[model samples]
Target: MLNFLKKNIALAWAKRHVSQTENFKNNAEKLQEELLLSLVKTAEKTLFGRSHQFEDIKTIKEFQDKVKINDYEDLKPYIEKVKRGQRSILWPETPEYFAKTSGTTSGSKYIPISKEGMPFQVKGAQSALFHYIAKKNNADFVNGKMIFLQGSPELEEVFGIKTGRLSGIVAHHIPNYLQKNRLPSWETNLIEDWETKVDKIVEETEHENMTLISGIPPWLVMYFEKLTEKHSKKIKQLFPNLQLIVTGGVNYEPYKDKMEFLLGGKVDIVQTFPASEGFFAFQDDYTKDGLLLLTNHGIFYEFIPLEQYGKPDTERLTLKDVELNKDYALILTTNSGLWAYSIGDVVRFTDKNPHRILVSGRTKHFTSAFGEHVIAFEVEEALKSTVLKYPAKITEFHLAPRVNAESELPYHEWFIEFEEEPANLNLFKEELDFQLRNRNSYYDDLISGNILQQLKISKLRKNAFNEYAKSQGKLGGQNKIPRLANDRKLADLLEIYKL
Candidate 1:
C-alpha cells in the first residue's frame, strides 16, 4: 500500500513536470535565448571565457561568431589542465568529477561534470520517465523495483578528480530517497566481471516485483536469457509485473524481435539518446518515430549540415532554423562549460512544433568508398527488413568495405554472428543485398554499373563479438560495437573467427 501511494505521488509530480515542459516547448525560442544568456553570463568568469572574450557576447549571433565549433581534440589541452587539478579552467569552480568514455577514434576521454551540470543530466533522464508515464498512464510500474543494468559505480582518481563510466557516475548518485527501489545492490553493482555481476543481479531480482528494466538491448538480452535459464521459464513468467523495457546505446531495430521473443510477452519499449556528454532525447509518443528534444534543459543546441561538416567556415543552424528530414551533425553548448562542442552524433528533425528528431548516425560512421554513401540508419533499416523476411537471427554483425587492388571491383564484407542460422544462407545473402540496394539509391547505382560487387558474408563463431569486446577492454556497460567502419580494421579483427 505504501509503495502504491508513493507511485501515485511520483506520478502526480511527473505529470506536473511534463505540463511545464510543454509550456517551454511552446515558447522554445524565448526559452532558448534565456538559456543562452544564462550560460554566457555564468561562463564569462572562467578561464576559457576570459580567453574567448565572453563578456563581448551579448547576442546569440555574437556568441556564435566568437566561439568556433570544437571537437574533443580542441579541448584536450584545457581538459589536461583540469585533470591536473586546476581551478576555474572551464567551469567557475573545479568540476566535481569527470565522466570517462571510450573514444571512437582516440583512446579514452574525460568529460567534466560540474556540480551545476550534474542535476541537468539527472533531470534529463527523470524527464524521460515522466514523459513515458504521462503518455502510457502506467504509474503502477514504479510500484515495483526498477533494474538499470549499468557499469560499476567504483571511482578512480584521475589527478584528484573522481572518474568512471558516465553510467557508473550516474548510478552512484541516484537520489537517496529512490535508492531502495533500484537494483542491484551497491556491492553487486561494483563487481567488475560482467558475467559474475549479471549472475548476482539475476539472483537478487529473480523473485522481486520487477516492473521496469533499462539497459542496452544486447546486455538486457543476455540478462533475460540467464533469468529464463535459471527459472526454467520466460521473463514474463518470472516477473509478472514487468511493464516496460527502456533501451539505448545501439540501434534496437535489429534486436527487437529477439528481445520480444525472450520476454515471452509484448511490453512497452522506450528509446533514449543518452551519452557521456548528456542525456539528449527520449521517445515521447507511442509511435516512436522520433524523440522529443528536451528544450528547457541546461543545454543550447546547434546543427551543421552533414555535407558542410568538415569544410572551412561552415554554417551552423539553431532549432528554429532546422528543416525536417535533413541530416545535420549535432553541436551543443552546455551549462557544463562546453562551448560549441560537437557531440559527434547526427540527427534529422521529424517535427518542427515539438522539435522531435531521429538519430541518423554518427558523424564519422559512414562509407562512400565507391560513391555509394551508406549511413547507419539505412543499414539498420535494410537489416531489419531482411531479417523479417528470413528465418535467421543475428547475435552481432559488422560491415566494412573490402578493396582488393588486384580485383576490378571492391565489395562490402559482412561479418555475422548468428543466433539462429538460416536454412539457406545463399538466399539470405541475396535478400539482404536486395534490401540494401533498394534502401540506398547510390548503392543500387554502383551495383548496376558494376562499380561494386555484391556484398560477401562470413559466418563468425558464437560469441565472436563478446570476445572481441573483451580483448578491447569494453566487454560491457554502455560500450557498443561500431556497425559500419570505413576501413578493414574491424573486418581484420573479425577475420580470426570466420568460418
Candidate 2:
C-alpha cells in the first residue's frame, strides 16, 4: 500500500512536470531569462558574484557579458579556497558537501554541492523513475527491491565538509523508507574491495524479489556474469520479476547484446545523462532516439559548436538557437553556483520540440591526429556493425592514433580483449575498417588518399583492462578505461599485456 501510494504521487508529479516541459519549449526564451535572473539575484551577494558584478546583470545578454565561460581550471582556485573552510566563495551558503570525480586532464576534481542544489539532484533522479512509471502506467515494480550497484557511501571530511563519490553522497540521501527496498546494505556498500562487495551483493540479493537494477553498464554486466556463474542459469531464472534496467555513465549500445543474452529475454532499458556536475537528462520516450532535457531544473544551458569549441570567439547558443543533428559542447550556469561552466561533454539535438539530445562524445575523447576526426558515437556504431557481421564479442577495447617516423603512413590502432574471437582474424579487421570508413567520411578520404593506413588490431590477454585498472586503483565504481586516445599512452599500456 505504501509503495502504491508513493508511485501514484510520483506519477502525478511527473505528469505535471512533463506537461510543463511543453511550456518550456514554447517559452524557452522567457524561461531562460527567468532562470538567469534568479541565479544572478541569489548569488549577487556571494564572493564570485561580487567579483563578477552580478548585481548589474538584469538580462541574459548582460549576464553573458559579465561572466566569462569557465572550465574546471577556472574554478579550481575558488574550489580550493572553499575546501579550506572559506564561506560564500562561489555559493551563497557554504557547500554542504563536495563530490569528487577523476578528471581527464587534471588529477582529481572536487565539485561543491550546496544545500539548495542537493534537492535538485535528488528530484532529477526521481524524475527519471517517475517518467518511466508514467509511460508504463504500472507501478508494481515499486514493491520489489531496486538494486543500485554503486560505490562506497563512507565519506571523509575535508575541513568539516563531507567528501566522497557523487553516488556515495546520493546514497546517504536515499529516503529511509526506500532503504529497505534497496540492495547491498550500507555496510556492504562501504566495503572498499569491489570483489568482496560483489560477493556480498550476490549473497544478499540472490533470493530477493529484484524488479529494477540500476548502475553503470560495465559494473552491471560484471554483476550479471557473477550471478549467472553462481546460479548456473540465466538472470531471468534468478529474478523472474525483473522488469527494468536503468543504465548511464557510459554508452550502452556496445553492451546491449551481451546484456540481453545474459538475461535470456528483452527488457526495458532506460538511459540517463547523470554526472557529478548535475543530472542533465533522461530517456523519457520509448523510442530511445534521444533523452529529454530537464529544462526547468534550475540550469541555464549554452551550446558551442564542436568545430568552434576551443576557439576564442565561439558563439554560444541558447535553447532557442539549437538545430537538429549538429554536435555542440554543453555549457551550464546552474543554481549550484556554476556559472558559464563548460562540462566537456558533446551532444547533438535530435528533437527540438521538447529539446531532446543524444550525448555524442566528450570534447577531449575524440581522435583527430591526421585530420580524420573520429568521435565516440561513430566508433561505437562502427564496432556494433562489425560485431553483427562477424563472430566476435568484445569484452573490452581501446583505440589510439599511431604516428611514427618508421611507418610509411599513420594508422588507428585497436587493442581488443575479446570474449569470442572471430574465425578469420583478417576478415574481422577488414570488416571493422570498412565499417569505420563508411561511418566517417574523413577517415574514408584519408584511406583513399593513402594518408592513413588500414586500422591495426592487436588482441590483448583476457582481463587486461581489469588488471590495468586495478593497478591504477580505479578498478570499479565509475572509473572506465578511456576508449579513445589521441596519443599512444593507452596503446603502450595495453601492448604490455598483448596475447
Candidate 3:
C-alpha cells in the first residue's frame, strides 16, 4: 500500500511538470532572455557583477557585450577569493558547498554551488526521472531499491565550506524519504577506495530488488561485470525487476552494446548532461536520440560555432540563433554566479523546436595530429557502425596518433578492450578504417594521399582501462577516459603505443 501511494504521487507530480516543460519548450527564447536579465540583476551587487556593470545591462546583447566568455583560468582569481571565505565575491551569498573536481592541468578545482542554485540541480535530476515515469506511464521502479555508484560521501571542510567530489556532494542531497530505498549502506559508501567500495556494493546489492541504477557508464559497467562474475549469472537473472538506467559525463554510444550485453536484456537509458558546474540536459524520451535542453533552469546559455571558437571576432549565439546539426561550444551563465563561462564542452543540436541536443565532444579533447581533427562523436559513431558488422562488444577504447619513424607511416591507433573479439581481426580493422574515413573527410584525404595508414587496433587485456584509471586515482565516480588524444601521453602511459 505504501509503494502504491508513492508511485501514484510520483505520477501526479510528473503530470504537473509536463505543463511546466511545455511552457519552457514553446517559450525557450523568451524564457532564456528573461533569465539572462534576472541573473544579471540578481548578481549586480556581487563583486563580479559590479565589476562587469551588470546593473546597467538590460538586454542579452548588452550583457554579452559587457562580459567576455571566460574559462576556469580567467575566473580562478575570484574562485580563490571565495575559497578564502570571501562573501559577495562571485555570487551574492556564501556557497552551501564546494564541488571539488579533478582538472587535467589545473589539478583540483573547487566549483561553488550556491544555496539558491542547489535546488535547481536537484530539480533537474528529479525531472529526468519524473519525465521518464510520465512518458512510460510506469513507476514500478520508484518502489524498488536504487543504487547510485559514486564518490565517497564523507566530506572535508575547507575554511568553513564543505568540499568534496561533485558526486559525493550530490549523494548528501538524496532526500530522507528515499533514504530507505537507496544503497549501499552509509558505512560502505564512505570507503575511499573504489575497488573495495565496488566489491562491498556488490555484496550488499547482489540479492536486493534493485530497480534503478545510476552512475557514469564506465563505473556502472564495472559494477555489472563484478556482479555477473561473482554470481556467474547475467544481470537479469539476478535483478529481474531492473528497469531504468541513468548515466552522464560521457557519450553512451560506444558502451551501449557492452552495457546491454551485461544487462542481459534491453533497458531504458536516461542520459543526462550534468557537470560540477550545473545540470544542462536530460533524455526526455526513450525513443529519441538527443537530450532536451532545459531552458527554464536558472541558466542562460550561449553557443559558439566549433569552427569559430577561440577567434577574436567569434559570435556568441543564443537559443534562437542555433541551427540544427551544427557543432557549437557550449557557454553558460548560471544563477550560481558563473558569468559567460565556457565549460569546454562541444554540443550539436539535433532538433530546433525545443532545442534537443547531443554532446558532440570536448573543445580541447580531440585528435588532430595529422590535421584530421577527429572528434569523439565521429569516432564513436564510426566505431558503432563498424561494430554492427564486426559483431564485437567493446569494454573501452581510446584513440591516439602514431607518428614515430621506427614504426612506419603515421596513423591513428586504437587501444580497445573487448569483451567479445571479432571473428576476423583483419576484416574488423578494415571495416573500422572504412567507417572512420566515411565520417571524417580529412582522414579519408590523408589515407587516399598515403600521408597516413589505416588506423591500427591494439587489443588490450581485460580490466586494462580500470587498471589505468586506478593508477591515476580516478577509478570511479564520473572520471571518464578521454576518447581522443592529440599526443601519445595516454598511449605512452598505458604502454599501448609500442606496436
Give the top-scoring candidate (lDDT): 3
Clashing pairs in 3: none
Residue-wise C-alpha lDDT for candidate 3, range 448-467, written one tens digit per residue: 99999988989888778888
Q: Would you estimate the TM-scores of all the predictions?
A: 0.96, 0.95, 0.97
Q: lDDT per residue, candidate 1, 1-499, as tens digits?
A: 8978887887898889888887877888778888988898898888899988989998889999889999988888888899998888887878877998878665688898888888877888788888888777768887789899999899999888889988899986787756878988989989988888899999999999999899998899889989998889988999989998888877777888789888898688889888777788888887857888887778899999988998989988988899999889999988777889999888999998888888888888887778677888888888888887887888888999988746468888889999898888898899989999998899999899988888989999988998999888777766788888788888898899887
lDDT per residue as tens, model 2, 1-499 = 7777877776776677666567766776678779889989999998899999989988887888888889999999888889999888888887888998988776788988888788777777787877787788766677888999999999999999999999999998887756878997889999988878888999999999999999998898889999999999999899998989988888888888789889997578899988887888889888866988987777899999988889887888898888999899999998777889999899999987778999988888888999877988889889998888897888888999989937478899999988889989899899999999998999999999999999989899888988988887888877988788788887887788898
Instruction: Tell me which residue pairs clash in candidate 1.
Output: none
lDDT, ranked from best to worst: 3, 2, 1
Instruction: Sort the candidates on TM-score, descending order.
Output: 3, 1, 2
> Model 2 misses residue 199 by how many Å?
1.5
Best by TM-score: 3
Report lDDT (Cα) of residue 483, candidate 3.
87
lDDT of each: 0.86, 0.86, 0.89
Candidate 2 deviant stretches above 4 angstroms:
1-22, 405-407
> Could you report the Cα RMSD, in angstroms, for every candidate shown?
1.8, 1.9, 1.5
lDDT, residue 143, model 3: 92
